[model samples]
Target: MISLLKASPAGDAVSALLDCHDRIRSFTALALRLARAHDLAEPEARDAAAAVHRYFSAALPLHARDEEESILPRLRGREPALDAALAVMVREHREHEAAVGRLLAACAAVSARPAELARVAPELEAAALDLERHFDEHLAAEERVLFPALRALLRPEDHQAVLAELRARRT
Candidate 1:
């Protein structure tokens, strides 16, 4: 798990989200390693499964809400060109959630039945790859288009409000 550092100062919403993208990448890589292991024993598989499940379950939803609720609405008025991309992102978030659920179930099953690990490994890899591929472009769009617009257009109060809303969701 990524350790908590200093709290993001007001107006650092974009930076925080970017940091989250990094964590997402890190966790996804870790999950892929765990999933692709050829001989995953019960205890190790359980630990890895728990870690992956905890991260996707906890952090991923908050990240989606940060985009869907806080960031996207603000962008719609200022950057109308982003409407289609935003819509796609919203749909992809739902897809990601479903994928995570399936991956979690498969991983949990492996913990209970170690012999099943080899059979389900491909499913786990597919789900992780799906999320990773989606996020690669999605994060690029946010960094390239959305976040820069937010930084340039948003008032200090707007930043504060977004940061507060994001923190509230986590709590």
Candidate 2:
């Protein structure tokens, strides 16, 4: 599946986005598991926290930018009805980032006080759960409504531009 996504052409950038969503799901699960762990000081726990921290701090923001800067505007230009949903999705992105920020802080605190794992676990778990719910709605909206609309409405050049922007961010 990943190989196919990498082979996707410019017009199939939606495939790439979907692949990103899959990665987000996997990473979120890992983060959730780490959050629920009873021992924060375990070597495995710290490793998981570091991995989640790196992913949320770096790759997640880039994924959001791909939507905000590249995909959403193009979709908005063509689909008026999408205005409301897009606005909500945009706000949700910020909420996701903010929640990640809080989770990161909590992870830091738990790392320093391994015995306080019980204290911070709920907050981290809640953040992960919220993110999962948000993704369920947001991804459905994009897959069912936004992506199809964009595919139908966007010009070839528009797709080319989106692909370039998405590629640029990773580089």
Candidate 3:
């Protein structure tokens, strides 16, 4: 398991962000599966919703805050031209927060009546897909530009400090 995580490009400071993406995908898939298989009133539906809510609640704020406050700022400090891209990222983060809020509210309303998932599922799916797209583009940009900038601007200690701070906040 450790080997596999290490083998991935997403290891290290980028780890938290990608892990959040994986969490989103995993929970969203399970939620959709449960919704399609059983009525929303079923325990499976609630389980799925609860699991999704829990993971998103925990990871979203941390991931966004880290990117907005620490990682992106570091990049901007290195390359001022990246200011535009960073601003776009921050705006997208806000949009993502709003989208997740809508999902949380929708899940709350539909949790007791899994039957309503037929109506709610599409919106949920769209939200998940939209987020995935955002992650894809954002991660690609960071990989190509920001991550390298981070490595260039900071020494080994400072680079590791960024990851350490992120992990500490998780606790």
Model 2 TM-score, all chains together: 0.81
- Give the winner by lDDT: 1 or 3: 1
Which residue pairs of candidate 3 clash? 40-114, 41-114
RMSD of each: 2.5, 3.3, 4.1
Task: Order the candidates by lDDT, highest first.
Answer: 1, 2, 3
Tens digit of per-residue lDDT, candidate 1, span 1-171: 333323564347787787888888888887788778876677787778777877888888888988999988887855556777788778878867777887778777776776777788898889888878877887787788777788888887887788778777776
lDDT tens digits, residue span 1-171, model 3: 112223235345655455655655676566556445534455667667666666667766776787777777677744566777788778877877766776666566566665566777777766666656666676567557665666567666665667676766766
Candidate 2 residue runs with Cα over 4 Å from true position: 1-6, 9-11, 39-41, 110-119
Q: Model 2 Cα RMSD, Å?
A: 3.3
Quote the positional error of residue 88 for candidate 3 in Å. Answer: 1.9
TM-scores of all predicted structures = 0.85, 0.81, 0.73
Worst window of 10 by summed lDDT in candidate 2: 1-10
Summed backbone clashes in each candidate are 0, 0, 2
Q: What is the lDDT of residue 27 in candidate 1?
A: 80
**Residue 140 error, candidate 2, Å:** 1.8
In candidate 2, residue 92 scores what lDDT? 82
